[model samples]
Target: MSDPITPLAKANIPNPKDGEIVAVAEDIWWIKMPLPFRLNHVNLYVLLADDGLTVIDTGIYSDHIAQCWDALLAAPPFTDHPIRRIVVTHYHPDHIGYAHSLSERTGAEVLMSQIEHEKSMALTTLDDVAFADMMIKRYRMFGFDQDILNALAERGNHYSDKMTKTPDAGYIQAGDRLTSLSGDWHIRCDRGHSEHHIGLYDPARRIYLSGDFLLPRITPNIATPLAAAVDDMLGHYFAYLAEMLTWGDDWLVLPGHDWAFHAVSTRAAGLIRHHQQRLAQLLDHADHAPLTVKSAMDALFPMELNEHERYFASGEAHAHLYHLVKQNAMICAPDQHGVDYYELR
Candidate 1:
């Protein structure tokens, strides 16, 4: 049965506010840039330094975003200094979309984690035909219908134009300390969410730039993508949570998607508990009978679904099921149709 589309779109809707520069500290400011996706904004940071300015996380490479950057640079706060460096938190399109262009314009050297830089460059050259075929085969193995599978195949091409060109240069590895106008920021790297997602911590100010690792209102999506060896994403996610929890509760969190908050410990605890609840729910469903990934997704997200939701739902379900299988709490057996049937161990 095809699910309705209304709830999916509504669930992923993005809320954009009037653009403003927020002073995070004495010489640091954050600018929220617009994006085209349902989660329609990204936070870009600017640091006023003695030598030059540093801009972090340029917005997606659209005409509108380019104009926004131009306007801001022309304004008073940013008019004096040239951008000496562009520090990207990760390689996501929303985070590094205008990196190449901005680096060219400002002569800023782009800095990112080595793992993120390699992954980002690979995305730029992904072959559409091969990618679509892989999506169809993966969905078929999970028991999605032809219609839903077809939609998933074409969705990637839809957003290809929004992706920015890869950076001219490469990345800065973890354990490298960044010194600028704001002083030294320590880089901490973790996996699970995205390969080698980098978070910056300034001990002096007790602030953490926690890219997509932590969000206030919504849970971060943990999906099992094709051609990835780390199939147990749920396990990796919990490990990442544990790593972040060690940063102490009092530190202010600067997230990629949500507003800045000081509840790092509380938010980390909540995320861990949320995943526990999701695992329990999956276990209960598996105990009743063997379930296909598609059926499990429908059970977990029992609302109107669309092409986007369907794609995400399958990936999320696969992540959880793979984790449970690894822990011996669930067993997956292949049927003649080639779909995996999962049940409680």
Candidate 2:
């Protein structure tokens, strides 16, 4: 069954019906698609043009989303217009999963950051069993018990499962401007969330298509890569947020997950505060005892999490601890078991 479209245009609809596309402006449209996570949805934008349409951020690959696309393209607004190019903001599974699928359908060019494209390719070649075993070993080093390790191994590589094979992509970078009938969008790239995350801003319209950069309600997950915990991922995130504060507060922020809102500086400041508080929490907990990533995770986020949540939570914990290490507030040294643990300096 096709999902029904609502009559009204939504600058901000908290939750539109599935497969519905609402107008954000005169020509641009917004659609929310289902995601298999706590966040639950990813926002996709369609820029209309007489020549062709430009899609910002493809939703994850799945049967249901495929149906939604079919219904969307077959309808008014989206009908007849070709998807000229797909501008992917990042390489997260939910954002880039269907880039190739839609590109294959519409004969559209896929545009992505070189870093994200390479990361996607590397992730595609990752063997599930090998990935699971490697994660088990790393989680063990982070002080995960055998039970959590077993659950993680069974989970395997969700990214490989969720992400469709990437298509050949044209590279976009900072300072590049994408011109279309709708408007000119300036590209800005930052590090941390994924190696190089892209955000698009339209100066004319004052719209910021912020993908996982500064979410409205929840702070975006700042995670260290599983292979190494030495990188200051959280620090990078803070630096990016600080830079965003200077971008002014008048821009309308269209985030990847949540509802659209204004006040970009306010959102950025709140996110910075959230992480700072988390860092403080971790620092105080470590003062009580030498802590592993697992211990820090429980202290910072003392809530029940399923296997999937655990994976992200572990990285978040390591990111904060390692950021403190970089700040010289903490030190990471291996214990007698060769397990890395954090202690106050």
Candidate 3:
């Protein structure tokens, strides 16, 4: 079913400058933080509590970001107000960046899903050689060449660069209720973008603070990393999309990136169709001959990619291939050379 039109126009949303807080609702502030990537920025929300402030999603750790947080938190309205807690939507570097540091600084509890917390801790202690070895094997199976394999190995231990410390987080599961200044926020966990991406919804106000699960126009990457090999990532994504379609169309969607939007059910349907098209394209491409994940990745995303981007590219291709196999629409198996290849069933 189609969704109702958004009450607010897209052009009506205010453009927030770096570190500048713009009120989305009563006492709820949206803060955009800068990032050194193609995506450019992340939106962090500050919620006013009776005693202090509750900060959600800390941007990556850096001297510049630190300065911005210091100045913003020390300014009026928040000058004497201490940070009550640090809540993360997921384990991604950008979302959980300064979680550990801020928790230490404010002595505030860090809250997130159990899997996100465990994964964050696991990545910190994960052995570099073992990780590199596993990545090399997976990449090689997906048809990566020797030179690219060496480059992937050199990429080594990426978690340390983005996250400075391990967060000792308190767990918040699906269906849990959190009391905020605005109203009672219910936690809903979805998988596809991450192992356990958390979404906060307030039914009374019809607002959803969607972490990367829902974005304005940009579709969140649906990749399956090694840790999520057993999970049907794309299947989970489609189910979650269907559920979002049932939400009241009037709810304002506060996403992790870009601007806040309202036509959520429309956006959810669009994302469902987007993945369906990608899956169809993969099937058509493989119909010609057995295709490697690398070949499928190139066909689906033709742009030149850096080493880091290549990781996501591989993951995305793997997601489609794995999902097709799960649905019995494609055949995936190893060849004599030990590389995995797919063909239309």
Q: Give per-residue CA lDDT, model 2, range 83-136, as digits (tens).
A: 888988888888999888999998999999998888788777778887887788
Count residue pairs with overlapping backbones in model 3: 0
Residue pairs in collision within model 2: none
**Taking the tens digit of each residue's C-alpha lDDT, what string does model 3 give over 125-151?**
766776787788888899988999897
> Comparing 2 and 3 by lDDT, which wins?
3
Runs of candidate 1 with Cα error greater than 4 angstroms are: 1-17, 156-159
Candidate 1 lDDT, 1-345, residue by residue in tens? 122211111112133353556666676777888777667788877777788787878888889998888887787467777788888877777888899899988789988887778777666766676667767778888888778777766666432356667786656767888765666888888766676787777888787787887776667777775545647877888998887677666777777876777667667777888778778888988878888888888877897876656667778888888889999998898899888899888
- The whole-model C-alpha lDDT of candidate 1 against the native structure comes to 0.75
lDDT of 3: 0.81
Candidates 1 and 2, the one with greater lDDT? 2
In terms of lDDT, the best-performing candidate is 3
Backbone collision tally, model 1: 1
The number of the candidate with the highest TM-score is 3
